[model samples]
Structure formats: structure tokens, C-alpha cells
Target: MTARAPQFCSMAWAGRPVAIEHQWIEAGPSNGPLLVFLHEGLGSVSMWRDFPSRLCERLGWQGLVYSRPGYGQSTPRPLDEPLPPDFLERQALEVLPALLQALGVDGTRRPLWLLGHSDGGSIALIHAAHHTDSVAGLVVLAPHIMVEDVSVASIAQAREAYQTTDLRERLARHHRDPDSAFWGWNDVWLSPAFRDWSIEAMLPALTCPVLAVQGQDDEYGTLQQVFGIAAAAPHTTVEVFASCGHSPHKDQTERLLDLVTTFTGASSPNHANI
Candidate 1:
């Protein structure tokens, strides 16, 4: 099924307010569990295609999908400006919480689940680590705990593709300003200071149940990412998909859905109150 048309909500960023593009995949019960989806570095609500809806329908739950400040139809970051090394940190520490509040998501009222991909997965880890009381569970796909040489190399290739190929045009279909989305993410991941960026230190702080998934053939990150999460957060359940690439949801959708459904179903009785 196609995702619903997106809505917008405003929040402060870098001392200035920006609009965030969001959509609600409201399925199942009226008071069912809520699963929030965090898109990848260059991803947005539209970029997620119909996966969010499919997951929600299969699980008989609801979902929220959004694009961060610079992606999709949301506010566009200045093309000339580059993101800070701590941009992902800010998204976790600041942007996400604010967006949640703005959208009236009260975890106390119902269980809150986070499903993230790539950079989004990192942000989910950071958020869950700090806001342990808020998040019910996590499903992180190809998350990064520490920078990998492979990740940097792939991102560099993406940069070249953006400049020399039709990547920009392709991305424009999903983003109002593809440059804003691509450069904001690409610049930071490739920066020298970002090479040392790692959330391994923060994983130990996670108190919620976590389902960490990685593809055996993921070009961006290795299995060590999930292994690292499992090591730090012993409560984490790790799954490695064999024929998958960076996106198991796209590459191995049915398998991923089955794993996530089982993981979330066991985490809370409210997984599907309906």
C-alpha cells in the first residue's frame, strides 16, 4: 500500500525553527501500539515507500514515519553549510524528543516502538540510551556503533555518484532539495572528526529490549555493528540476514517483518491490543 500524504510539524534546530515532514500509518486498533520509523541518512518519509504501512498492517499496529529537517519536503538545509560532527547526536538528543512531544506521543499512555535504518538506527540507539523510560523496544537495521572503513568508503562512492551520475535526479523524486539531504548527511559522515564518532559507549545505558538486524552482505556496515550492540546491551537480540544488503527491509522484507513481529510481540502485551 502507498503511504498516506505527509503532514508537517515545526521544531527548533540550530536556534531556528524548521518543519519536519511526517506521515501516520494508522492501522489496527485505535489505541494500539505505536511504532515510529526513523529514516536513513539520505532517507525521508517518501523514501521508505510502503514498508511502514506494510509493517503496521502485518502487526496490526500503528506507525509514524518522518524526514528530519533537511530531507524530503521538510525544511531544506543551506546547501553551502555543512552539518556538525554531532548532527546525529543532536537529532537524538533534541530533534526526536521535540518531534514526539509535538506529535502528542505519550509513551506512558501506550507502548512506543522505534524502528530505524542506518543513521536512523544510530539515532534510535542514542535516544533509547538516554530516554530509557520512554522507549519500549527498538529494531535497528544496519546500525553503526563505530565508524567502519567500509562505511566511509561506501559513502564516498555515494558522493561521487551524486556528482557524476543520476543519483541526484533519482533522489529528487523523494526530496524537495536533494542536495540538502545528501550533503548534510554525506559531509558529516566523511568528515575527519566524524571518523571517531561512535555510540558504543552509549549502548550500555540502554534498558529497553532491542532487536538489532544486519545483513551479511551489507555494503555500509559489518555484522560487528549488531555484535557490538549485543555485547553492550545484553538484552539485545541480534539477527543477521544472509542474502541482504544494507536494507533488509527492502532486500528481505518478509523475513525482516517476521523477525520484528516476533520481537515486538514478546516485548509487551500491548504489541497489538486490538
Candidate 2:
């Protein structure tokens, strides 16, 4: 089966019901474990292009792909609204669980693996740590365990580029409110307090196998990101690809996909969770 049209999952958040946009890729074994694809900071479901479909089809596993609030066709962020400093934490600790429940994804009833990129990867790590019983394993790409100066600089550059270039217009095609996605991600990363943000403490709590992959030439972060994860989480594996940039799925699709497919299949609960 191929990917189905987008669907919505509604749940209460901040005292109001919120709808998250999601799609199902029904290409694989109906009984196979689920692979949830979490996109990067600036990414939406459409920004992922056909990568999710290709990966799920090849692995023969059902997949769920979604765009968080203020991104893609989901609810747009209000212009005057500001995202909280613990936005990523909230997304992992609260939003994700609510979304899973709204979609009837109970980890106790089925195996669940998360494939997250960039910010999504960090969120996955946090979620895996807090909900070990629900997560089977994780394949995180370019995850940030700690804030870096390079990250701030790159985001600052993006801010400048947005004003001088056509970045906003291009992103508009993907996000309902491009400003919402851009500012929500940029402002938080560049904030002074955000410099001290780190998820290293959460790593030790993750008991499942973690395959942390990052590009050798990633500008947004460094090897420290994945290496830190490996050092913190004993079951973590690190992979740094050369001649690649930040987005491994886009920079090195074939190799990344192969590594993830094999990793997920190998991480049986009997092996990783043990």
C-alpha cells in the first residue's frame, strides 16, 4: 500500500483543543512495528518530500508522519504569540503522547520506533527517556543534546536570509504561516537562556538502543551531539558520514536509510530493552 491522504488528530492543549496534521503510509506489513517520522525544526510533512514513503516501503513497516502545530497545514501560530522556552520539551513530554493516544498508538500494545531529524530527534530522545515502556528504540539524525554557538550563528544567519532572500516565500508553500514556523524555531534557539539548554541528563534515562547519526560536516551542530549521546547512553551507536551536511536524509539518503532499516530491525526488545 502507498501513503494515504492526510488526517487530523485533535486533543486538548493549553486549555483548548488542537489539531495535528498527519498521514499514514500503509506500504508495509500490517503486523509490522510502527515507524514514526519526525521532521526537522524548519520541516513540515511536505518538506520531507518522498523520503518517508520510500523508507517505509522498503522496510515494509507502517509509518506515521505528521506536522506539529504552527507548521505545515496544521494550525498556524498567532503573530503576537511567542513560543515558550521549553517548547521542545513540551512537544516531547506532552504533545507527542497526546497525539499518540489520539491516534490510538499504545506502545504497550505494539512496537514503536521513532526516526527523528534535527529538533525532532531531540524531541524523540526526550520522549524515549520519559516513556521507555512505550518506545522500542530510536534512530535519531542530527539530534542536539546541548546547545552550541554554531547553532545560534546559523539560526541568526537564517534570520538575516529570511529578510533579504526568498526563504519566507519558499517556506510559505510548505507552512500555512511561514513566519510562525520560522520565528517559533529561530527565536527560541537564539534566545539567551536557550544557550544553556541540554538534554544530556535525559540520555542516561533512555534504556533502548539508540542509533545517533550526524553528518561529519553538519553546520548546525557537531560530532559532540552524537558523541555525547553515545557517552551518556551506553546502548547508543554513533555514525558520522563524511561529505555530508546537516540533513543526513537529504545529504545521504541511501546510506542513512540502510543504516536505520537495519538498526530498527536488529533492536528487538529481547536485544535492546533487555
Candidate 3:
């Protein structure tokens, strides 16, 4: 039998229509903390595999996983337009909050934790910095604090491989509009102005306890990314894994989950992860 196409739901953000495919796994109790998983630059909800469910079950918490606009079953971007520079900012300031509100997640009533990887990691950082009072904790894996020449080079290479190799076909399994996801992200990163992009100054605004993890073998970024978070947010705890790459949740699932469980369990000014 042929595989079934994924389904998506739509919503409005700032008067513009947006689409996002999502799944919420309820664990423990209705009042339990919410752990939101943010996917990588090229990732979607389906791309997360069983990691979110496994982590939620182990941690005894609820999980919220969704594909950002232009990925998975989410809304597709216009073919003629380039993605805005504030795409990440738009997610942090508008999309996420709108999503939570739509899902009936009350920031004032329950604790919220963010688990983000790669580009998602950067978005999580921006959200935490801007909405310090709402976020309980953060788990950033391979987040980019500043643009690096190596990152730009790797992204360029990925664009080439996607066009000339099987990368596009592979990505099609995870993205509803593969071209939208590919070009939306690829074009932004490859843009000349994007080279100087950095969120270092915004890091200091983050008040919640943070756990920054990075793989030693990550091709996209280096220890500097994780260390940058530590340096900016002194309350942050850092962990480095050997033989791991940009995707720690995928590469080092067990170890990364353990660190998340431990870090989230510890009580801080923000409500502890339970």
C-alpha cells in the first residue's frame, strides 16, 4: 500500500495565516509540566522519530511537538519571496505564543520548558531571552550563538548536495513542501547579510537556568556555540559529548535525556521540571 500523506491544521498569527502540523502526548497528569520540542533547521515533527515520546515518558512529563511554518505539513512559503530576516524572531515573538494560546497552554498556570536543536535551539534562546518570566528552563543542543564561516560553508555544501544528490528526496519524507523548507532555510543562511547574524547580546537577557549541550564532532558548529551561552548566561550548565554531531537527541539520546531529566528536576526560581 502507498504511504498516506501527513495532515496539517492552520491558524492565524498577526493577521496572517500560518499552518503547523503537531502532536501532543499527554503524560502523568494534566497539570504536569509542558516540554516543547523544537526541530532543527531542516527538521519537522515526523523527523523527531520517537525521541519526544521516549523523553516525555521517562521524565513523566507532557510533550508538545510541532513543525514550524514551511516544514513538514505546515504552511508553505510563497515561491517568489525570500524568507524574512526576522523569521526566527517572528517565531519567538508571535508563532510560539500564538500556538500555546491556541493549545490552551497557560503560561501563568503551568511550568514551561523548551527543548530545541540546531536552528530550533537558536529560536528557543531568543524566546527565553525575550520572555524570561514565562520560560522555566531551556535545553539547547548545538545552538548557534553567532554566525561562523564554517556554518556558512557547510550550509552551502548542503544546498549543492540537496540539488545534485538524494538529499532532496530524503528530505521530502519529512517536509510537506520540500522546496519550501529547503529554499526558505537555505536561502536565508546563504544570504550575504546573514553572515554577520549573531544573538550574543540577547543572551544576557535570559534569566532561566539553561542546559547547553553540543556534540564534539558536530560539523555545523563548535564548542564555542555552547560555551558562548554559558559565558552569556552564567546560570547555564554546559555538557559536551564525544563522537556526537549537531543532533545530540538523535546521536546521543540516552545521555542527552539524562542530562535533561537532571537539569529539569533541579528546583530554581522558575518551577522545576517534574
Candidate 4:
């Protein structure tokens, strides 16, 4: 489960060119199923730590982990312009496909399984909804289908923390420009227009198998996030883990791994070999 060095891929995003930081975790077989790991808001490749490597090793699948445009060691967001309300949509629709194409990941030849956390999970859902044939399945952790009051309250607290506490200093360890990563996500989420943002309508369009996992004590969101997903995509399997928060991979790693192993095994039986 040793991790390799970070790699960079150049692409255009948000009307400007940028570089994305990424890594590949190869295991078991060269041609085994690929699982792409998407990080959360204010998250980067380094922030994921060893989760991708461990998951790929356990599942015997190849893994791809990356930092979105404004996060990690990749290109920083422009200081002058604030991100638009549809930023997440642009990431899923524009950034992801272009990056995959640049990396020679042809989903038609081999569809990819996405493992996304929080904001990343929302991106995965949007991508699958638009490109049904290119996605195999999805494992979404604390994904938001609709913005909740609790989400706003937490984000507001984060804003306060960023200004008053040492949160920015800590985030600087993961991101090249903490302001770019934090404000780009924070400003939009707390915006008046973004309050009405919802990807719930896109759920019914998803044809891939989905496993929505959430924590019972998540401060950022509620179980309604997964429940709304289940209501729309009746085929989805939903799990709410007790004694867990926004991050199941961090708080309940073992149980989360077991759940993913079982879900992926059933979804892609051939790829679960060790």
C-alpha cells in the first residue's frame, strides 16, 4: 500500500488553464477495475492520506486520487474573482472529464468507479448523471443533494474559524494557497443564491449503482442528504454509521472499508480479488 509521488496534469477550468495534482495507486492487476477517489471541499490529494492506497489494496483494484483546480499543489484560484454558484457543477462536468481524457482514462473501454467524499461525492453524482455509460458505480460519503440549514450553520462556523482560529495555518499544510481552497468553496456555499442550489433533480438520471454512506453525528449535514438520494434513486443502498461524523473513512475506517468491499464486490465481482 505504498504511495507514489504526486503527478500533474494540465487542463482548462473556470475559463482559465490550470494544473491538477494526482496520484495512482496500482494493485493486484494492471487492468483491474479503477476506483477514482475524489476529495472534499477544502481537500487535496495529500489530505486523503493513505485511504486510497488502503482501499485499493483491500479491494485489489487500481486507484486514482486527485486535487481539484483550487486545492492541493495544483493551480490556485485567482484572487480577484470569487467562484460562481455553479462551481461544483463545472468541476464535475468540465474538470473531471477533461482530466480523465488527458490521463487516457477512456470510460467507454473501462468504466470507472468513483469514491467521493462530501463535495467530491456531489461531483461524482453529477458526472454519473451526465455520463451514465462511463461510470460503473459510486460510493458517496456525506454527499449533499440539497443544501441544508445545518450545512450553512457549519460552513458559517468554518468561516469564523478561518478568520479567528489556526484553521488556515493547518489547511496550508495541504493546499498551496489556503485562501483559494477555502474561500472558493466557502463563499459560494454561504451565498444567498447558492442557498437554492440542489442537484436532487440529477439523481434520477444516474444509472450506475450507488452506495450512499453517512454518519449519524455529522455536523455539516443530515441523513436527509442520503435519504433524498434513496428516494430519487430507489436502487441506491444507504447506510448511516453511528459514532461517526462527516468523515466515515476517518471515524469508522474498518466498518466503512467492509461496507465498500461488500458493495464493490457485488457490483464488480471480478475486481474484488486480492
TM-score of 2: 0.96
Per-model TM-score, in order, reads 0.96, 0.96, 0.94, 0.96
| Residue-wise C-alpha lDDT for candidate 1, range 201-221, written one tens digit per residue | 899999889999999999998
Off by over 4 Å in 2: 269-274
Query: How does model 2 fare in lDDT?
Result: 0.88
Ten residues in a row with the worst lDDT in model 1? 265-274
Model 2: which ten-residue window has the lowest total lDDT? Answer: 265-274
- Residues 1-274, candidate 3, lDDT per residue (tens digit)? 1112344556796567887788886664567678899999999989999888888887787788999988888887776778777778788778888888887887657788899999999999999999876788899999988889889889999999998999999999988789999999999998987778899999999988899999999999979999999998999999999999888898989998888888887844246433
If the candidates were sorted by their TM-score against the true structure, best first, what order would they fall in? 4, 2, 1, 3
**Clashing residue pairs, backbone N/CA/C < 3 A, model 4:** none
Tens-digit lDDT track of model 2 for 1-274? 4899888887887677777899999976655578898889999999999999999887878899999888998887776878887888998999889898899887766778889999999999999999999788899999998999898899999999999999999999999889999999998899887889998988899988999999989999989999999998989989999999999999999998898878876776232323
Tell me the lDDT of model 1 at 129.
95
Overall lDDT per candidate, in order of appearance = 0.90, 0.88, 0.85, 0.90
Worst 10 residues of 4 by lDDT: 265-274
